[model samples]
Target: MSESVAPVSRRGFLAGATALGAPAPAVPAVAQPRAGIVILIDRNDPHVMGHAISYSGNLSRYFTGKGQAVPPIEVVANGLGIDVFRADKSPLKEPLATLRQMIPTVVFSMCASSKSIAESRENLTIQLIDGARLVPFGIGRMVELQRKGWAYVHG
Candidate 1:
């Protein structure tokens, strides 16, 4: 009598192996930089700044989840974005408050020329932190930051 042997397929073998509770293969961990991202906000509208701020905050959280460190982010406002700096004219109360909670995590920068215009031409009382560095131009500052190896993100 000839003995019959069942043909074993690769899938069957794998199934049997899995049934034996074989450990899963280890995956190589990917290395990511712990550097922060620089977000440049140069909107001329309060609503736009609010949206930009929200975008920055969301991006920061996303980078943190991907095992990457987000570098210091600065939201430089000039032209019309300075409206958010004003107490009365500011329309982004909620967004600004959320940004304030991030505090030192995110930096705020305003254009020197815009502030000058606000004071001299508009006569508006705008408040900004001392940490907010004033630059001669906002777009130029963004380019400078990019040239300095800082990742430039615009909202």
Candidate 2:
């Protein structure tokens, strides 16, 4: 007589493995980062800002779909990128607002140096959209965030 074994169902296999102390699956750090991420935008293009927003939103969706908490995300703008956050001139106001609504923890920051230069060149006070903050130096902020273990993405 030949020996025979019954097929195991997925659930049964999992249960058997668990009983044997098998480790549970782990999600990647990027999917549910503990230290969060920083998105850098250094251009004066609306397209780049839109793309950064989309990328941030996608990151949010990725982790949330898996029932994971979104890590803190900061979109840091420098140089001509400062214009993207202008309250009066930006064409991406709606998209930026939408991204904020989706990820309340997401932050928008502009470089003070850039803003000052733009103001001097244009001879007008540049007001950032509500909730957008100004950092002393964009590069410094990036480095600080990195020092704290936050992931950086150039958008």
Candidate 3:
């Protein structure tokens, strides 16, 4: 007995070869434990600022609650939100301090542009609370953090 074998067409063979030679789809990198978080706060309302602070604290708790280490968190304040960082003007001075102590990795950032404008308009020097740093621009800082694979939160 003789057995007959079917021949593959040139088109079918080329298609199969192309499919096999195609590169696999790229995958997104998983977030590492070292990844950070950036929070944007641009409102002037005291309630809003309070909420932002609370939100950050809650995030820290979330990590700890899961028995995981908390990542670095940055709260960037701009526009009217800069007022929340003013040492003498902020109603949250004590709370801010407590929050910082509770979460050492949490940082509060003030926008230099907003500070300059606020000082010029209000005719009062702006003072930052302890642990708060100044960034050239709030939005820019957030963008940089995001590029570095940091999570983002707006409050």
Q: What TM-score does each of the candidates earn?
A: 0.64, 0.77, 0.77
lDDT per residue for candidate 2 within 38-82, as digits (tens), equals 999999887888889899999999999999998899999999888
Residue-by-residue lDDT tens digits, candidate 1, 44-150? 66556766778777877887789877667777777867665555566776666767686457777778888888788866656764445577887777777776667
- Clashing residue pairs in candidate 1, if any? 35-71, 36-70, 36-71, 37-71
Q: How well is each residue in 59-114 modelled by candidate 3, as lDDT tens digits? A: 98999999988888899998889888988788788888889989987889999999
Looking at candidate 3, the ten consecutive residues that score lowest on lDDT are: 24-33
Highest-scoring model, lDDT: 2
Model 2 TM-score (2 dp) = 0.77
Local distance difference test, candidate 3: 0.87
What lDDT, from 0 to 1, does candidate 1 have? 0.69
Error of 2 at 151 (Å): 0.8
Q: Which regions of candidate 2 deviate over 4 angstroms?
A: 1-34
Per-candidate clash tally: 4, 0, 0
Please tell me which model should have the higher lDDT, number 1 or number 3.
3
Deviation (Å) of 121 in candidate 1: 1.7
